[model samples]
Target: MAEEFRLRSVAAVAYGPATLFGLAEGAILPVIALSAIDRGATTAIAALVGALIGIGSLVTNIPAGVLATRVGERRSMLLAAAVTVAGLVICLVQAGSGPWALVLYGAGVLLIGMASSVYSLARQTYLTEMVPPHMRARALSTLGGTMRVGLFAGPFAGAGAMHLWGLPGAYCVGLVAIAAAAVLVYRAPELELTAEHRAAAASITTRDMIKRRWRTYVTLGSGVLLLSAIRQARQTVIPLWAAHLGLSPTTSSIIYGVAGAIDALTFYPAGKVMDRYGRRWVAVPSTIVLGASFVLMPLTGGAVSLALAGMVMGFGNGIGSGIVMTLGADVSPAIGRPTHIGIWNELADIGTGIGPVILSAVTALAGLGPGIIVSGVVGFGAAATLWTYIPRSGALRQARAECHD
Candidate 1:
């Protein structure tokens, strides 16, 4: 039975490439801005150049879905890998000032970012095809787990290389990681479509696909978007709050690291609970816990208090490892799935891009604490949305849960 399938079965096929891809991304993130600065751009321009990568991902997400649907996930990843290598090559050799350098640098990072959306969408689609509904949460959670683990470890690897070769060394590290991921993917099996899948694919247009589920996309999708916003807030809120309290960079890093460690440990348990019970069993509480933790961050007056708040925030996040993706999987159709998940992912990424902006804007106008509290409010809003909607939106999954009982 699909339920009897062990999580270990696809370790290499799914997790290995995800880890390598994530590692490549994580390693490059710290250096993208530095590389821009190294290319003779001022700080402001460098930050803007660095942002191109994210902008690339955000704009291309839905297109990536179409790409994956047409070419298949594995091929999409290979194409993405090739694009990353080209981007890295340009970053390595291109130099000097002027509009050309800026254009070249901007182009390189944009390609890398665009490749990221393809890689992510393909990977998610691949796992959805490979895993059955009963164990999907675990499969995808473990997938998220592997990617997070790589992201956590990637900086150390990139840092070590930079001590010897400067900024170029870090870019080389990313090059190698992405090249290796491509190799792993090249050797993996193609996604095999069953007769049922074939028929579904033939009958439905992606447009019709959205038409059938437009309400869910507009309504239910908002819950996941809010969840994405709250999740992304963690990056900004803790550090800003810590700085507001006059904590040093090193102290803030330590507190954030501890919180991350807690966050890393929750994926499997979260998936297990979601699969065994239902998404709501985990979603509602995770949202509230995360929201409450954000609300508590500004109240923490010292490093110790901030550390506790960070830990709570971490757990709140950790326990919902694959919640958004799982929800996407739960609602996605066999036909035009890439399109469905792509749009779903686009919503989440939109939230991801905007969350910090909203916080900073509010902080600028209202005060730091209030901005953070507003994120908590977003979390509460997410919690309410998920609680009210998950049952209605994911009724198929709910019916399956009832049957299991």
Candidate 2:
């Protein structure tokens, strides 16, 4: 079994396409706001335009599951790839259009986000079905690790391209990346559908799935939401705090890069620990460390201290790569895996979208330190949620197996 678990096919089949898609997404992220600014939009409107990507994904999550259910995983991915290509094309042209072209660019960004929701959910479902339970965490964690690698590399790729051509060159890079990913997904063999999957044919509504597994959703799902929130909040908190401390933009980027390095290094080890020891071993420590680090960030007086705190936060996050998806897979019924994952991702994204909002709102009212503290408290809540619930479902299977052995 250990020999079987190395799974070179899984590595290539799963991680390869994820890397391309992640790279495309990472490359295009900065382009959205930049494009809007280029079109002469106000800063506030530019920010809103940039956010359309998340909003598009948020709205499409449930529909993505339905689409995956109807079309099957491989086909769904190809379709998403097609949509991404179309979006990138629009973005490529929008850069040269008039100022109202910002709306066109926003529309393009929205389409890309919709495609991402479908692509992400389909791949997660496919992996959940294919990987055995014992090796599930490693497979998914590496999927996440590959994504980190892709996203980390994407900006550099885009910057190089943009320097040669212009803003439109970034979209060209994304187009190439997504096109390659689509080809991989197309050539891959189709997933073998179960009897239940064939029977699902649009009858399995999100409403039906919720009624059945609402308990799991409320408990473990709560943890997923909080974990996502605090994690997303870190994106805003780290940079803003650095700026608050009077750090220069270059210093801030360097600090961020260092923390990201720490994060990218931890995923595989974390997966191994989750697989061999238990999810609790990683879940509790990751959340506590994440929460405590947020609490500690405000105390940092300068560059060295801030970078250290960021590294601590990064380690907490890195270890818990795919924790949400792993837990979702552990409990999702085979009969409606796509729908269940859709709902699970919906919760996760909702948390992701709200995190920055909460942080900004808190910053407006009580100042920055208190907002950081609030996220720290949210981390504690995530730790508590995972602590109480893991044994009830995912971990219990392993515990029983260990006793039997």
Candidate 3:
């Protein structure tokens, strides 16, 4: 009745800045490293820059979410945009190497993660607030699909911007995107708090909030951490190794793009599966398949093998990405959906952001093959954990089917 689908799209647009932050990182990380090298920064310094961002994200993401809940999702969105813009301005104006660049870029990247988390948490909570329970899975799936498309497109766009206009130009583009997101958010409607929501908000304390959703939080956090580790290992290390093996940057980018596209295309079907079967049923097998794909990654050479690996990984991720978020929404404490989603999202970011750094360190210590192989093993191990503890959604699906029949 409220044009639920259109509003969700608008909410997603409100999240465009966060999406841009993600793309900016993916697109600009390689370029940034190259720029560092060009500036005569040591490999250690380059690695440090990456680590700073992760550390900052791990620290600020939870607080950002908490703040979002206190202020309202719309306010949080605007706050995130303002923070991101300020961060960009810092990076744009900063000069010198050593402490100065490190401080500025480190702070910039931290705000990137914080602001991005705010936008993301707000988007998910706002969308869930708008959609009916029956339509939630499908709606989330569509959002996830759009997210995948944005993520996939962002890096390439960043790369193109970098190619044509250099670092400064790319930063300018990111800034423009953030500004556009802020404008969209300003135009989007505020979430109407139902009586239940208002009551929940009034009654739930911070401690009580965590106690209420502990199982849901722990499960989602663990699952996303494992998922992020598996995915980031490839996203970060494999391409570098591929480059060392004489593959061109453009070729590597193409492979990554293809994988992401495959994931985006399959998201809706995966959501349908979750809606029909259950979240757990879709997640468990897909998680395993994703791990297996990572395990298979190091077993081949050149673009063909990498492409195959990407396809496998994409298929696995596509099956459950949206459903997972919907599951988070389902289990979240009604009063603090934004805060709960943010905490889990932070865990996700921790896993994702720290993943590349950890994998890279492993590769540096023991070479790429062993590092990648271990990543696969760890992912599989995580999958086994999910299988053992998480409940299946099949019963819910069956009940609905019976009703329909």
Q: Which candidate number would show the highest lDDT if scored against the true structure?
A: 2
TM-score against native, each model: 0.93, 0.95, 0.84
Residue pairs with clashing backbones, model 3: none
Score residue 83 of candidate 2 by CA lDDT: 95
Tell me the lDDT of candidate 1: 0.84
- Model 2 scores worst on lDDT over the 10 consecutive residues at 396-405
lDDT of 2 by residue, 168-272 (tens): 878888999998898788788888876664676467899999999899899889998999999999987778999999999989988988888788889988887
Give the candidate number with the greatest TM-score.
2
Rank candidates, lDDT, best first: 2, 1, 3
Which lDDT tens digits does candidate 1 get at residues 1-405? 545455656665678888887788778888988888777889999989988887998998888888887778889989999999998888877668677887798899999989988888998989887776778888888888888877877777889989999888878888999988888889888799666664555456667767888888887789999999989888878888888999999999889888987887888988888888888888889999999998998888999999999999999988888888888888877677888888899889988887888898898899999999999999999998988778543635633653463
Task: Report lDDT (CA) for all predictions.
Answer: 0.84, 0.85, 0.68
| Runs off by more than 4 Å, candidate 3 | 1-27, 34-40, 194-205, 240-246, 353-367, 394-405
Q: Write the per-residue lDDT of candidate 3 for residues 262-309, one digit (tens) a residue.
A: 887887767666666666677777778877887787776878988888
Report the Cα RMSD per candidate: 2.9, 2.7, 4.3
Clashes of each: 0, 0, 0
Task: Give me candidate 1's TM-score against the actual structure.
Answer: 0.93
